[model samples]
Target: MNVLPQSKHYNLTHYQQRYNWDCGLSCILMILSTTQREQFLNNFEAICKEEGFGSSTWTIDLCYLLQRYQVRHEYYTQTLGIDPNYTQHMYYSKIIDKDEKRVTRKFKDAKAHGLRVMQRTVDMDVIIKHLARNGPVILLTNASLLTCDICKRNALEKFGYAGHYVVLCGYDMDSKKLYYHNPEVQDGHICRCLSEAMDTARTAFGTDQDIIFIYEQQQSSDQ
Candidate 1:
């Protein structure tokens, strides 16, 4: 039986990020706090310190943090290892090595802890499938292309890739819109963007197409 998928929405308490680089953590908290789990809800500062949050964080760090909290999820990234091409780019050249070392450590730690890391790019179809199956997602995206409130409020012109995190909670097929919580907002709120634009930001350069597809339980695929 073919079941037509309608708009899917999940309840969540928005968490506007506290720090410039903590959008990823804030997004994770937004989803987890909405659920029964509360371990991470009240430990924002502690988690940041433990995770060594700093100038920048990577997809691997997020996956490892999810594992640390015993949350079930699948980690996907187009890059199997740190991309050498990033170091050559002027925008990231200064911080690329520092980020590389940190992310490499997290990658090894996540694997050592038995998390399955998928070496693949995330696309719109995959995102839609996850939502259809009742799973929420947090993925890296280019803020410049995302064009959130800050972009419009500041009348900013899109130029370089500014990597940020966003949670995908729902989608309306009829409207061709994807809905998610944007932790970048000063006062957190659900953000809606065109599916095509969202995918473009998700797969943008510097993002590395990194994403975390979360399951609703613990140890769902920890083998």
Candidate 2:
């Protein structure tokens, strides 16, 4: 249970979602806030609209945006056994359907923009490792998984809001608490028990696994 010495939180009031379904975009903005990237800050909405990220944003949409802005990043999701039905349930169930072929195209677009993307199944250990290194992770989870009572209640009222995203910024191992930024929450940060955080993250896609997006700034020399 290693924790960062201090919390890394970001205030992204300006980037709050204009639509109820833009949590994914908001989460990405929160991560970009950490880097203090002026370009993204200046043209946030334009970038989102250009990428066609409105009601729902997929992993590839985020990767493409990051790559377009020259932000180095990677994406991760637990690998599940080959189950076409399960895949349909997770992605195509929505009104805005995304098939494997569409998803693959998004990945190709991101690569074309020069973004490094990777998808793999990872355990809590891997997540903790990233937080230990002071890396902010974008976690896709059910909005109800949030510890905030108001947030959970709102999620219940909104249809199709079970799927949401948040940024995990830090943890206090000594206190066994996890700190994160909820774009839906007005407050800058929210704190909950480490166990609760993990439990909520497990609700994603009913897989009880994590869908994580990690972004590392590319060194100028590397570019």
Candidate 3:
């Protein structure tokens, strides 16, 4: 693993998600920096909506959004089909087939855009290396195990392991903590969880161990 940045030094602006389903999109906005986004952010939201974001923000859907903005990154996944945990989701029964088709089509579109989608698993070492290089990582995690305030407040945890995306900002080896920005809350920046909990929350069946390894310049007026 590469030398990790001190958690206190990783300073990405914390942009909270506006809705329960927009966490994935919000992660992208935080990575791309919302400062010069007067026009960029508007178009970003427009493209997100144009590409099936109003309903749900799937992993492949995020790739399409990044490609549209000329963002540099690799889309990684542990599965190439419908979310295996679809059966556990609230509306899974009605939307399994539809969600599968949508995921397949958008996946192909993401490829046609020349985005590199890597099919494999990622571990803590990989996440740390990217953070060491000052790159941002967007991770899919089970919200239930994350001890999220919003989840507790809304009784969302009752639904069980809802899949959510967060921006992994840094880690503290000494503290054995994984730090990330949970868009679900207003003070989501650098929210810390035990290293064990982080792995468990993200590697669950619903997650597919999905990750977006962004290789942007880390430049933004806001940062």
Index of the highest-lDDT prediction: 1
Candidates sorted by lDDT, descending order? 1, 3, 2
lDDT of 3: 0.72
Clash totals, every prediction: 0, 0, 0
Question: Which runs in model 2 stand beyond 4 Å of their true positions?
Answer: 1-15, 33-45, 79-83, 86-92, 96-102, 149-161, 206-210, 213-223
TM-scores for all predictions? 0.85, 0.70, 0.82
- Candidate 3 collision pairs: none
- Please write out the lDDT profile of model 3 over residues 1-223, one tens digit for every residue: 5444555335677888877778897887777655544455666566656776556778888887777677788988987767666766674555665567777877766667798987889788778777666477899887766653223433343566677899877676778776778887765546777767778888976788999988866443121
Deviation (Å) of 2 in candidate 1: 4.3
User: Which candidate's TM-score is highest?
Assistant: 1
Between prediction 2 and prediction 3, which has the larger TM-score?
A: 3
Model 3, which residues run further than 4 Å from truth? 1-8, 40-45, 83-91, 148-159, 218-223
Candidate 1 least-lDDT 10 residues: 147-156
lDDT of 1: 0.75
- Cα lDDT of model 2 by residue, 131-187, tens digit: 655356777776654564334443345443266667776665665666666667665
**Local distance difference test, per candidate?**
0.75, 0.57, 0.72
Better of 2 and 3 by lDDT: 3
Pairs that collide, model 2: none
